[model samples]
Target: MRITPRPPETVAPADIDLFDPERFRSGDQHGAWRTLRETAPVWWHERAGQSGFWCVTRYAECERVLKDYRNFSSEHGTILASVGAPDPAGGATISLMDPPRHTALRTQAMRSFSHTVVRNRTPRVTARVAALVDRLGEGEQDLAELARSLPMAVTGELMGIEEQYWDRLAHWSAVGLTPEDPAFAVGASTAATLSTSHHEIFACFMEIIAHKRANPGDDLISALIALAPGGRPMDDGTLLLNCYSFMAGANSTTPHVINHTVLALAERPDLWRSVAADETLVPALVEEGARWTSTPYHLVRRAVNDVVLAGVPIAAGDWVCAWLPSANRDESVFADPYEFSLRTLPSPHLGFGAGPHYCIGAPLSRMALGVFFRELVRRFDGVDITAPPQHLYSNWINGFSSVPVRARRRPAVASSMPAAREGACAHGTS
Candidate 1:
């Protein structure tokens, strides 16, 4: 089942409601985003009985808002759900805090995701992805399941989270992000589902933190426990909130990028064949995949003071959202932005975002994607979609909940190639 790309719609600013998850589900939102980018770059999005927000769609404007942390505060919230109210995790978690404090905590957190650490872990990640890819049998398989497992495995190991808790944490992370989706909803109301999932994750992390305190290890939690920023240790609440932030950030986004990329390849078999013939193209393929997916679709920030963006006046205390997918597709920044081609080297897409809040896990994410796709094309001739992807019903996360596919396993003779044999055995011995 080849999924046809949705064409952009000619929508007026008044018809656009960035808060509606349904539009994203139907792919109509792409048209709306396109319209907003071309016509109203800085749009005041208003809906009945809900607070309005300044939606910045163009690349230049979105980059400006995200980088200008002093003028726009994240403490209020980083998603539309917290509009008109301060985020509960505000000031405690890295994503929700502004600079000085955010700077200190992020600096400490960076220790876990440093380039050296990620590079050292590459062989292990490659091995893990290879094993997972190898498990896919030839008939039909849900690529989403494979996509979901890799991140949890890599991130859980880094945090020293026990394997027994990985599955539940992955589920809770999904639920916490998209409580409105019936597939992930745990309770009657969206609020209840969100609360339940968050509570479960927090409780689970508390248990892990307790264990780490008694028996420290070389992991993120243990590192944070030992950290003394500015001569003061991070409090329990802040520590716990950061743990949640780390897990959610790791588990939620990367999997979707995997799904979207695989699905894109499935749709374009010619591209898949090209990638299969050349191993070196994998890196560019990974970059193109990240740019095309733009999984963490939009990030919300509140204005600290009155500001002018794109000739539009945004009042102090107003909500401002930077649509990453739109910015990535901005014609000015990317040539033929919508085309999923490997030619765009050094992609300037805001897939990981920009400035102070750029994703810390980006290196790990790129490594995982590169390994997965490189191994995937080598092990399988190609993949065929068996059903249309079921996209998550959320404005925040742009991903599929299910992508049913049938793998075409490569012939055994193909494994005789030196590159194929090398990739198969590339897993590091730890």
Candidate 2:
């Protein structure tokens, strides 16, 4: 459906510069977002110099929105921050789309990202992750670089793409996810960038699909292509859109989670120290980081049917952003939500989202995090950092281009560990 921006007066107040990506990038946004959650849990945010959105801060209200698909639709493409960005896929990707169409295509695309697929691809993933850690010697260093490299490289390898394109993939993924910052807004250029990448990726997929069509292989593309809905093959557009959905928001979010998780550890030494001591706790650390980082902080939902949340009345056509970073730290739900805790239990964090739209790649993300962190932590006994991490300026991705992490020579936790103890990282730390 074509959507033209309504008149300025008709726009909601939540659309404003206050939600600008630059503002959040300049500083950690938790404090301000937290204040709003408490003071005006469900408030309108219309600021000068930004697209408008309604911010839902409290956990209960956010839950109400996520679980009740009828009340809030995920079809609007899931981002309230980058209101102006154009999707190169012609319309909504899976995450942005509502069900039936979204569900059918997602079932195929999700097959590639399934746990077995990610597990099958782990050896390669582990090698890249370990190489990154090996370069950083034991010392105080920038955590962001250490965090981002694993997922950035993983995204490429998993897609069967060459390593050369990791930088561009990371860039696009970051840009698409965060819109509250100074990162370039979506427009003609974004479409160009997206189109360029899509062209390459689609070409690659088309080749693979054709190969599978002619001579079948065990790779995911083949399996997806083999899928027959009522004895007919999946169409090109559905297949392409499904694959595109996998690469869209995930690639950026993965690295951002890694960067933020490590950063969180650095800040909360207690948490970091705990995870380092017991590698088993690393999974919890990963979850906490993903929850706290809130790199892809805003998730948009359209009112599927009129409903009320947090005592606020809603109507169909109205849009809402479940400010996840804020919701994850809801005072009512978490004890000292602002305080980072590796020991936190039964985490109800919305990092992977909730209900049907909950990220289909949850297992892949979890597996990646498990392999990346466990191997790194186990290998580097004295994997101390070199210095503080730098932050990226992009509004869509909370990450760093460079983090100078030169670590000391710690005993190898395993035989095949990637040492990024020292090297040139793609994105620098803030």
Candidate 3:
């Protein structure tokens, strides 16, 4: 008689070490996302001790939910419900806010983030990327150290936060994003992490705000300081809220684009080779890498009214999350969804989000990554992954925590030596 092996106990995507934060931080969990994206395009998941939610796993549906924000409002919490500390100062969750109000604030921000401003910074951003890569010396370097720093430096410049405050800002951002970890919530022998960091960092923003008020400049801080809508100055509450929003937006997303793009290209020699052959391919690489990077995995939305999605009923007050990363890999929308292809055109990935609330800094982030990666492949002779890339301690943002790389290139080689650089590798980032 033949006895079959026992099947492993199936775990829900919401529960499958997905929220442990540490697992993602350490790079242990993988592949359930692919399974979810395929089998349960939009499935309901239940978590122990907290409210469950509908996980939207396909690109077609994810785009629908994100673009039609009116039907699926995001004004509540953006992801899973917290059995932990909620933001103490929470008035409106900016990321989750519905439009009209969201539109007003976003418009104010667009004035500072317009296309020309980002284009002007490209050279400086390219210089930073070059210097950082040149410093690598073909040895194992923490991708986080270089990748994380570039975005923080840019945020520091944009926010007037100063270099001395950069590390502290990074710390708060990690804590602020990673709530299930020991950082955010207060408990026995500890105070709420958000409370502690909010007071300290918000105070720092206060100084910047005050300084800009007295002596304005071309930076975002000064622009926000001087901006008044409808002939009334923005109140202190809205002002602080907008400032904090910018910090959360830029610092969280930009670094991920850089870290994951490099990791993705290093893992897939073909795309790297394309960039090596033609630096112009950098833009496509940037788009596809970011498309694959999968930041803001799910944009959770509250049902604004009774709505039907793909014939499924969504009751008002119910929470639904659009699984964008899963969507990007949807086999329906993509051909051989898991493979990295820089040549794929008319690509429709939801990494920067979609519709009215689509990320305002997208053009900036895209240009920066394209230039950075182009310069890297152009300069380095050999770029290889030395160790498995690690991911951050959050479920909301799908990005690398660490990507160990060994990029080989003759330091003194001619600037235009080879038409292509990536020779051997495997994997994708967006």
Candidate with best lDDT: 1
Model 1 lDDT tens row, 1-430: 5463545666876777778899888764777788988888998887688788889999999999999999998888898888877788887788988898889878977888888888988777776777777666547888887788788777787887887888888888888988999888889899999999989998889999999999998788998888876788888887888889899898878999888888888778889989989978998999888888887889899998999998999999999999988998888888877678886478788899898999989988888888889888877888878888899898999888898888888887344433434545775422
How many clashes in each candidate? 0, 62, 15
Q: Which stretches of candidate 2 lie above 4 Å from their native place?
A: 1-18, 47-51, 81-92, 108-111, 114-124, 138-149, 152-212, 228-234, 381-388, 411-430
For model 3, residues 1-430, the per-residue Cα lDDT tens digits are 1111111233465555445556556543336566666566667666678766776777878888888877877666566543133333333434646777667656777866788888776555555555566656547787665766666555566556666777777767656654445534443322466567667668777777887788887777777667765466776666676777778777667777777666656656676766778877777878777776677666777677888877678777777877676777766777765666674555788888888778887877777677667667767765667766656667676665566777687566544433122211111100
Per-prediction RMSD in angstroms? 2.2, 8.1, 7.0
Q: Candidate 1 vs candidate 2: which has greater TM-score?
A: 1
Model 1: colliding residue pairs? none
Tens-digit lDDT string for candidate 2 (1-430): 1111111121232433345556655565665566667567777666566545677878888877787776787765566533434234423455666566657656876667777788776665655665666555445555554554555566654554445655655555545443322333444565565455556656655665565678765545566677765467778876766556666656667776766565555445565556668878977777887777775676777776777777777777677778787787777888767666774555888887786678876777787777667755655543333444446655445566545554444354444443332212432221
Compute each candidate's TM-score over C-alphas. 0.94, 0.77, 0.83
C-alpha lDDT score of every prediction, in listed order: 0.84, 0.61, 0.65
* Model 3 C-alpha lDDT versus the unseen true structure: 0.65
Give the Å error, residue 101, model 1: 1.0
